[model samples]
Target: MDEHPEPGHDPAVGALDPRAELSEFLRTRRARLKPEDVGLRSFGRYRRVPGLRREELAQLAGVSAAYYTRLEQGNGRHVSAEVLDAIARALRLSDAEHAHLTHLAKPKQHKKKPAVRTQQVSGPLRTLLDTMDGVPASIVGRRSDILAWNRMAAAVFGNWAELPAQEQNWVRLVFLRPEYRDLFADWERKANDVVCQLRLDAGSHPHDPQLSALVGELSVKSEDFRRLWATRDVTVKCNGVQRLHHPLVGELDLRVESFHLADDHEQMLLTSHAEPGSPSAEALRLLASWGTDATTAGAGTPPTRTA
Candidate 1:
């Protein structure tokens, strides 16, 4: 046994029970839908259960009530793909959500001992980060870890390179750190996005002990995280505009873009760029020029004199 486990791998975090996860995911999805939302007539009848009843969902998905009930109970053994698709349609799940559903219903076989390797940034990838001068770019691992970043990223975002390895996760930063809450103009949106991404990861890697630990820590520390996690919403924000409030720069509206590495799908290259000739672009240039000094100033620390 590797005495020193990976940073996110806490023995006490406890492995996630996939069956329980599936049940909760199904329950939450079903709870969010109403009878009329799926074109079913409610007839103003008093309803005990929120959203669509199991029987109603079964009818919409063209499955038997008992069958849907069994699947929802986390017993997805021998479930057909077509039936899963029908259920997803009935739930009106997004593409990401549908994928999550599939993963939950038919998880891959787990090894007796799950791998606990630490993720690393390839040298070429590091060089690539350095070459992206104006664009703030970072390489994020599958577990949302900040594996590597460029100077521009440190200048525009916080100085991630200076932080301890374990603290370099997106979910932890968004939920556990007050600074991040202040950094995003719309903190709630950012929180939702991070949680949704985590949800997607959860469905795919239900047996990941590190992920289970991260979820456990976040759920205990953040009421908002607990609320968002319970929603079971899943999404991957590939392209979007993020509003930010930087300490040095007044305000910035940057276009965020993410691309999965061709060779390693588990790693994603995320970059943010401002529109050409925009004030945000000018701010980025200033930060780039100042570089480490700007990072120092951003932290409200006076530059040291070295004569």
Candidate 2:
């Protein structure tokens, strides 16, 4: 990755321009829906646009084309909730997408000053992570930064503790590091999930400079990141399954769960574990015995015990 910012990048802090973001998001959403998909007839033989036209979408949403056009142009300062709901229905948006639209249209008032403090893991949370013996767990802060991680997490995901503070981000690790690209069995799917989660975060906190900077950096460095970020997908990370190819362990399918911290919603406790009595479970057992050294163990190293 280049240490210098890409040419034309603002030297100040990074932030998604709300108006531009809203316009692009609405355009993409509208482009994904066809007239037939929404039970509308195609009146013309050769449609100029990819999906439904602006007027057609406005008609479907039960609003004037002028009003819808204004909204789509990112002038949603006076847009009503009922109208937004109608538009969301017309676009066939998911719950997450609907929320993202709402956030874009009706952004919260931010403080005059920008946030600068770094997130920290509390001592109690650190203790909790340490006590979660066999589970691979980590506390992730904004931009998927690995704030704190346990021994199992180090063994499974590599030692984040050894990385520089700014380099301990999931996006950075997954896109910038070749090892992580090989680590995930389904690299494309995992990349989409990571970008979607970041999109959701971007919508919720559009004024976050650090997040904007992270996005800018990734966009400059990784073509895959640039492609995925443009999709405008949004999703809340609750639970999922990830297949990993650990260097020490051959292959492991782990259930991934994320729980947002009650007091600090910006932070989440992420854990990955395998099923009981499975080969993956046995693999975890072996890694636990090897401890943090499992990260340094070469992929070709002979297994001390059979799974």
Scored by lDDT, the top model is: 2
How far off is residue 142 in model 1, in Å? 1.4
Supply candidate 2's per-residue lDDT for 60: 91
lDDT of 2 by residue, 96-179 (tens): 999999988998886675675679999999999999998999998878788999999988998887889899999899899999
TM per candidate comes to 0.92, 0.92
Candidate 1 — which pairs collide?
none
> What's the distance in Å from true for residue 298, model 1?
4.2
153, model 1: CA deviation in Å? Answer: 0.2
User: What's the residue-level lDDT of 154 in candidate 2?
Assistant: 89
- The lDDT of model 1 is 0.84
lDDT of each structure?
A: 0.84, 0.85
lDDT of candidate model 2 versus the reference = 0.85
Worst 10 residues of 2 by lDDT: 2-11
